[model samples]
Each structure stands twice: as C-alpha cells, then as structure tokens.
Target: MGERVLIALGGNAMTAADGSASPDDQRRAVEGAMRHVTALITAGHQVTLTHGNGPQVGNLLLKNQIAADVVPPVPLDWCGAQTQATIGALVLNALEGRAAVVVTRTLVDPGDPAFQDPVKPIGRYFTEEQAGHFEKLGQTWRRFDRGWRRVVASPEPLEILDAPAVEALVAAGFTVVAAGGGGVPVARDDAGRLVGVEAVIDKDLAAAMLARAVNATVLVIATDVPQAVVGFGTADARPIGSITAAELRVLQAAGHFAGGSMGPKVEAVLRFVEQGGDRAVITSLEDIGAAVNGAAGTVVHR
Candidate 1:
C-alpha cells in the first residue's frame, strides 16, 4: 500500500541563483521537478504539494517598486497569493490537470513574537546604499551572503485554512497542490473575519502543520542538498543520513545549521516527526525517488 506524502518544494528548484526566472523559465523548471512527482504518483503514493515563494514574490515586489509611480503596490500577503496562483498553475499544468490547486490561506496569530522581530528575508539583494535607501522608506533590510535584502516577520502558522479542501481533493484521489507561499499568511479580526497580514510564513513549517492536518504519513522537503549537513560551508561538514529527532535536536542546539537557511528545514523535519508523523525525508530533487524508497537522503524518525 502507498502512504500519503506531502512534499514541500524549495524555491531554489524553481528560480535561478540571481532570482530572475521568467514564467517560461519557471514552467520549464517546474516541469523538470514534476517528472519526479510523476514518478511518485506512478508508484501509488498519494501526493500533496506545497512550495516556497520567496523568489517569485520578490520578483513581484521588485516590479511593484519599479512601477510604483504607475500603479499601487500590492501588500506582502497579496504578493504571496499571486505567486500561489502563478506557481500553482505551473505545477497544475505539469500534472496535466490531474491535480487541483487550492488557493489556500494559513492562519497565524497576530501576536506571534516573530512579528516584533522580522527575520525572514525576501526579494532581490541591494547594495549597502540602496538598502539604506529602502530602510529610510520604512522597509527592513538585512545583510546576507549575496547582499542586503528585505526581511519580513515570519510568524508561525497556527492552521491551514484550506486544508480541508486539500484533504478532500486528496481523498478523491487527486494530487493536490496547496499552501503555496505558506498560503498567504492571514489572521482573524475581532469580528472573526479573515484579514491578510504583512508577513511571510516559513513554507516548511507550514508544510509540517499541513502534513499533520491532512494526516500525511510521509513528509519530504526537497532542497538543494541531498541531505542535511552539520558544519555546513566548512571543511568539516558532514551529511546526515538517518538521524533520530533527539540527536538532530542536539546538533541544532549546537548551532550547526544557520537560522537563515537549513535551520528551519531541520526544525520542520523534527516538528513533523515529534508531532506524530511516521517519517520525514530531507533530500534534493535529483534523489527524491530514492529518498522516498529509503535508499537516499536524510531520514528522520522519532
């Protein structure tokens, strides 16, 4: 029997290093990644997909800024929603319309501590002077390996608002594409109305929550690396094959993973396992087939 699997697609798999992927480019890239997904479906695993939107949303943000004089700029949440449609279309097409793209929304707490301390970076890199200019305009910018980029509050996801829709689709035997860009982070108002917020929710964390919501047995996070590593970017770096949640937690606490990059991924893997998921795999797209079969990648268990 096949297990229900939730795969979180990394932004690196869709966009280029410099973050300039046109729709045609993204379509080609998504098609390449979907071949792996197609293989999984062929093997009988029911699949649900979620994807990161940092690059896509960033491109939209840049466009908004460049044309600010001609048009009003869209909010962060709107940008997120737009990418959900854009990428969702690409994935849906690659699946030959055999899948459903749910325009999902993620419920978040308005008071999440992350709001006060924005750290999730998005958009294209800017020079020190350009970053300073944006800072003066009230946007926060942070220095990263590439350059300074815009950072937004990354609140923890409380629930996936459209998870039921995704579940129904999957239960009906449809491969579901959902929670794109963490489902456009939203919160409830005093009147219990859904209100979009100016924040980005970490897609991996959201995927874990969605996995638990939909009762998925397997969670796969596809990234640039074949497996999670300790001492990353160092000569002493090592690839972690199979690790228990407790052991991975120790390495995480010791700061082997950088908060900006691999930390959230490892955290998501632990979150899924500790929260009752049977297993989770962190692997690259090239190895997804083997990873699902337990022949490759870092497998995490309780």
Candidate 2:
C-alpha cells in the first residue's frame, strides 16, 4: 500500500542563491525538484506539494516598488496570488496526469500580536540605503545576518480552508499543489466570512497544518541546510539525524535552533509527528530524494 506524503519544499529546493528569478530559471528549478517528486510517485507514494514563495514574492514586491510611481502598488494578497499561479503552473507542467493549484486560505487571529510587530521578512535582501528608502515609504525593515530585509506580519496559521480540496485531489490521484506563501493569510469576520490580511504566513507551519488535515503519513521539509543541527554555524556544530519528537522538543527549548530558520522547521515537524504522522524529514534541497528514501537528512518521529 502507498503512503501519503506531504512535501513542503523550501525556496532553495527550487531556486539557487546565485540564480536569477526569471521564468526560465524558475521552470528549470521546478523541473529539478520535481524529479524527486517523480521518484516518490514511482515508489508508489501519494504526493502533495507546497513551497515557499519568499524569493518569487520578493521579486514581485520589487516590481511593485519599481513601478510604484506609474501604477498603484499591488496588495500582498494579490502578490501571493501571482506566486501561487506562477509556481503552481510550473510544477503542474512537470507533473504527469491531472493536477490543480488550489488558492489556499489559512485562518489566523486578526488580533494576533504578530500584526503589532511584524517580523517575517519577504523579498530580496536590501542594503542599508535601500532598507532606509523603504522605511521612508512607511515600510518596515530589519537587519539580518544576510543584510537588511523587509519585514511583514507572519501570524500563526489557525486553519487551512482548502484542505478538503487537497485531500480530494490526492484521492483522485492528482498531484496537489497549494499553500504558497502560507496560504494567503486570511481571517474570518464576525459573520464567518473570510477577510484577507496583508501578511505572509510561515510556510512550514502552514505545511504541517496541511499534513495533519489531510492525514498524511509523512511530511518532508526540504531546506537549504542539510538537516537540523546543534550549535549551528559554529565550528562545533553537529548534525542531528533521527530524533524522537519528545527529545527534539527538549532540544528546541534548550535553544539549539534559531527563530528565523531551523527553529520553525523543527517546531513544524514535531507538530506533524505528535499529531500521528509516521515520520517528518528535514533535509537539504539536493538530498530530497535520499531523504525520502531514509538514506539521508534528519528524521523526526513520535
């Protein structure tokens, strides 16, 4: 029997750091990533895919700013739409049989404290001068180790509105692609109608929610790093292979992960496993094939 798998693709899995964000470049990147997906499919595993739109959306944001004088700026929700369409189409092109990109909406607390102080960075890294320029336009920026970056609200996801569609797609033997930029952050009104928010959602958390909702057995988080590690970025840093979710939670509380990066991935995987997933993986873009085969990368289990 085939196991259901939900793959949360990190940006680096689809695009390279030195690569430009042209359509051709992105297509090439998607094709490469899909090779791993194809492998999983051949191995008789049902697959659903989600990806981070940090770079793609960042490029769109750049276009928004560059054309601000001539055209009204596009809303964050619309930018998410553009990325979902673009990336979804790219992946669906590589996938055989029927597939569809469901525009996902995730419910979040409208009063979430993240809105008061935005911390999620999207788009390209900017120099101090560029960051200052955006700040003057009433935008927010924070200095990262990679340099200054634009900050936006990243509220925790409460629910995935399109989860049923994802489940249906997989049931129909369709490769489902959804939840770009954390499912176009939205919240419900008093009457229960969804109201779109101007924010980006954490991709990993969103993917984990999708996994649990669809009852996927495996959740694969492919990132730039090889796997979760201890003392990251230091000479004494060490890779963590298979670990129980309980022990991983202890290590997380010990501060072995950084908030902006590995921390969220660890938290997301732990949630997946604790919620009854058989396995969760954290691995590099290049190792996705091996990671899924249990030959490489970090694995988290209950």
Candidate 3:
C-alpha cells in the first residue's frame, strides 16, 4: 500500500558541493534530486517536498548588498518567498510538470524568544574585523567554522497556513512541493492579519509540522549523508540504523549531534515520531527509496 510521505531536503539538494550557483547548476541539481522523488512516486507513495534555501537566499542577500545604492534591498521574508517560487519551480519542472507548488506561509509567534537571541546564520561570510563593524552597527553576527555571518531569528513554526492547499493537491493525486525555506515566516498582527516577519524557520522542523498536518505516515529528511552517526568524528563513529525514538532522544541529550547540522534533523525526526507520526527516516537523497522501506538510512519509530 502507498503511504503519504513528506520529504525535507537539505540545502545541498539545490546546489553542488563544488559551490556552483549558476542557473544551470541549480536546475541540474534539482533534476538530480527529483530522480529519487520520482522513484518513490513510481513505487506508489504520495510524496510532498520541502527544501532548505540557505545558499540561494544568501546569494540574494549578497546581491542586495552589492546593488544597494541603485535599488532598495529586499527584506528577508521577501527573499525567502522568492526562493520558494524559484526552487519550487525547479522541482515542479524536474517532475515533468506533474506537481503543484504552493507559495506557503508559516505562522510564528511574534514573541518567540528566538527573536531576542538571533542565532540562525545567513548571507555571506565576513572577517572578524567586518563582523566587529557590523556588531557596532547593531547587527548580530556569529562566527562559524567557515567564517562570520549575519544571524537572524529562527522562530518556531506554529502553523503552516497553506497546509490545506497542500492536502487538497495531494488528495487530487498531485505531487506537491510546499514550504520552501520554512514557508516565509509570518506572524499575526494586533488586528489578526498575517504579515511577513523578518525571520527564518528551520526547514526540517517545518517539514515535520507539515507532515503531521497532512497526516503523513512517513517523514523523510534527506541530507548529504547516507545516515547520521554517533561519535561523528572519532574512530568509534558509527552509522545509526533502525532505532526507537526514545533511544535517539537519549543520544541527542548525550550531545551526539551538533547543533548546526545533524542536530536539527534529529530533533525534527524525534518531534514527528513522538507526535503521532508512524515513523521518520533520515537519509541521503540518493537512497531515499530504500530508506522509505527501511532498507537504508537511520529509521526512527515510536
């Protein structure tokens, strides 16, 4: 029998490891990723896709900075919405026009504590001196292993506003793509109006929420790695296979995952499984089909 599957793609799905960002490169990447998706579809699973937009949005922000004098820079929410359209288009086209793309919106709390502590990194990297200058100008910047970059608030996604549209499309037998870049983070105003907010929400977390909203039986988080590892850097490092959600949570609390990378993915999977999802899998995009069947990747279940 077919299952409703929600696949959350990591940023690498839209770009190459070679750092190629040209239009052709992006299309080619999406085409490559969609091959796996099509395989699942052919096998009878109803699949919906969501992807990260870090690199694409960062490039847009860089362009805004370089062309600031001639043109007014676009806001963060706008940049996110743009990527949703752009990447969603690529995914739809790659599926040979068989899918629907929803320019979705996610509701967040304006009072989310993440706003007070900006920690989600975005845009181009800067040197220590450059970061210092930006800090003095009241911008939040953080240094990563790569370099210093501007950090923005990443709020929790309370609701996927367009989830009904997604469900409708799926019920009509359409492969749906929604919630790119966490659905353009929005919050309600005093008058109960939905307004875009200058914030980013974690794509994996949003994917889990969407999966639950649509009553999806499986959530697949596709990343660059074939599977998540414990003791990731050392000799004892080993890939995690099928495990109960309770066991995974213990490892997460033991600090096996890094906050920036695998941590969010693990958290997202745990949330889905603990909150009524039958199971969730974390795997590389290339092995998504096998992962879905419990033949590959790190499978987590209740």
Candidate 4:
C-alpha cells in the first residue's frame, strides 16, 4: 500500500503577483499547484489537499461590506466558509474529475480565547485615512505599507466536520480537498447542532488536525519559501533542512519563528509529528517533490 499524505497549501500557491483573483488567474495558479501534487500522486502517494483562503475571504468580506446597504453583509465565518466552497470547487474543476472538493466545516470551542481578541488580518489593504474611517466605526485595524485593514480572531481548529467524508474519498482512491480557510469555524450549540462562529481558524493548525483525523503518515505544508528559515531576514539567517520535533519545539520556545508567519508552520509541524505522523515538510509548492525525496526543504520528524 502507498503512503497517505495530506498537503496544506499556502495562499501564495494560488495567488498571483498582480493580486488578481480572477478565475483564469486562479486556474493558472491551480495548474502550477497540481504539478507538485501530481508528482506525488504519480509517485504512488494517496493525497488529500487543504488550502488557505486569506486573500479570497478578505475579498469576500469587502464585497459583503460594500453591498451591505442593499443586502445585509454576511459575517466573517460565513464568508470564510463561502471561500472554502468557492476555492474547493475551483480545485475540483481544475482536477478534471481526478479529485473531489468537499465543502468542509470545522468545529471550534465557543469559549476559545481568540473570540475575545480578533487579531488575524483579512481583506484588501487601505490607506491610513481610509483605515482611520473604519477604525472610527469600531473595526480593528492593522497597518501595512499600502494602508490598514480589519483583522478578525483566528482560533485554533478543534475538529474538521467533514473528516469522515474526506477519509471516505481517500479510501475510495479519490484525492480530497477539504478544510479551506480552516474549515469555516463552527461550534456546537447546546442542542448539539453545528453553528457558525465569527472567527477565522488558522489554516495550518486545521491542516494538522485534519492530518491526525485521517491518520496520514506525512504532512506537507507548501509555503512561498523553499525551506523554513531561522533568523529570517538578518545576515545570520539560516535554513533548516531537517530537525526532530523536540529540537523544533526548543527553537520555537526561543522565538526563532515570527508569530505572523513562520510560527504557525513550525507549530503545525510539531503538533503533527507529536501526534505520531511520520514526517512533516515545509517547502515551496514547486519543491514539493524534491522535499518529499529529501533533496530540499525543512523536514520535521518525531
């Protein structure tokens, strides 16, 4: 039997330099993404996919806000769920019947601390003046070079609601795409009915949870970088090729990874490995094949 792998795709894998989210542009990105995934499939790996929707969800939120006067704006959680379905459909279409895209939902604890402090940034950038306007309206803001944008809480994922469906697809020899935008954060009501919450769940953390749920042996997180780096930008910056989970945790404790970027990736890896996953690799989408073969990227082990 071939090894089963769960691939967590980063936003850049589907994003373009021009930031255009047109279907054609996304198709092009998906084409590039499939090349890496296809290589693994051809090499006899049973693959399941998950992806980020930071940019897409942000755009959805902006559209909702703009159309609010005529139609009430949807909440962020619903917007995230919508992006997951939209992007998952795009991925399924791109696969040309080779894979199945499941509109997945993930369950989170209603009491998660993130709800108290929505800190994850989403949507389009704006000028300082424009940001100030939103800020005055009581929206949380984060400033970037282009301007500022509203950020929302990104809680950790507890369970992927569609895991059984994903596993069924994988067992039936189909590639699965689920947990987009961290599976659209949801929590169970007192009656045990799933209800959407107003938070984004970190996609990487959700991916790790999905991997565990599916009993995948390998977890590959495809990011923009070819390898995980230490001391990211300075002259002493170094690339991490391979490391044990314990060592990675030590480095994490020392703050070698930035919270907004590399930190989540590293944390995901450690979690997966600790959960008995064979290995987790962090590498660029283009280098996925090489990374799997140990020719490139950072590989974390138990």
Listed in order, each prediction's TM-score against the native is 0.93, 0.92, 0.94, 0.92
**Predicted candidate 2 versus true structure: per-residue lDDT over 48-119, tens digit per residue:** 899988778888899987887788777788888788888998898988657778988888998899989998
Candidates in descending lDDT order: 3, 1, 2, 4
The TM-score that candidate 3 achieves is 0.94
Model 3: residues >4 Å from true position, as ranges?
Answer: 127-139, 142-148
lDDT of 4 by residue, 239-287 (tens): 9988999999998998899998999999998999999999999999888
Q: How many pairs of residues in model 4 come into backbone collision? A: 2
What lDDT is obtained when candidate 1 is compared to the true structure? Answer: 0.88
The residue-by-residue lDDT of candidate 3 on 1-302, one tens digit each, is 98899999888889987867789889999999999999999999999999999889989988876676578778789999999999998998999846999999999999999999988888888898877865675568888998899899999899999999999998999999999988889999999998888899999999999999988999999999999999999999999999999999999999999998999999999999999999999999898999888889999998
Superior by TM-score: candidate 1 or candidate 3:
3
Candidate 1 local lDDT, 13-33, one digit each (tens): 787655558887788889999
Model 4 vs. true fold: TM: 0.92
Ranking by TM-score: 3, 1, 4, 2
TM-score for candidate 1, residues paired by index: 0.93
How many backbone clashes does every candidate have?
A: 0, 1, 0, 2
Candidate 1 colliding pairs, count: 0
Give stretches of model 4 more than 4 Å off. 126-148
Please list the residue runs of candidate 1 whose C-alpha ends up more than 4 Å from where it truly belongs after superposition. 16-19, 127-138, 142-148
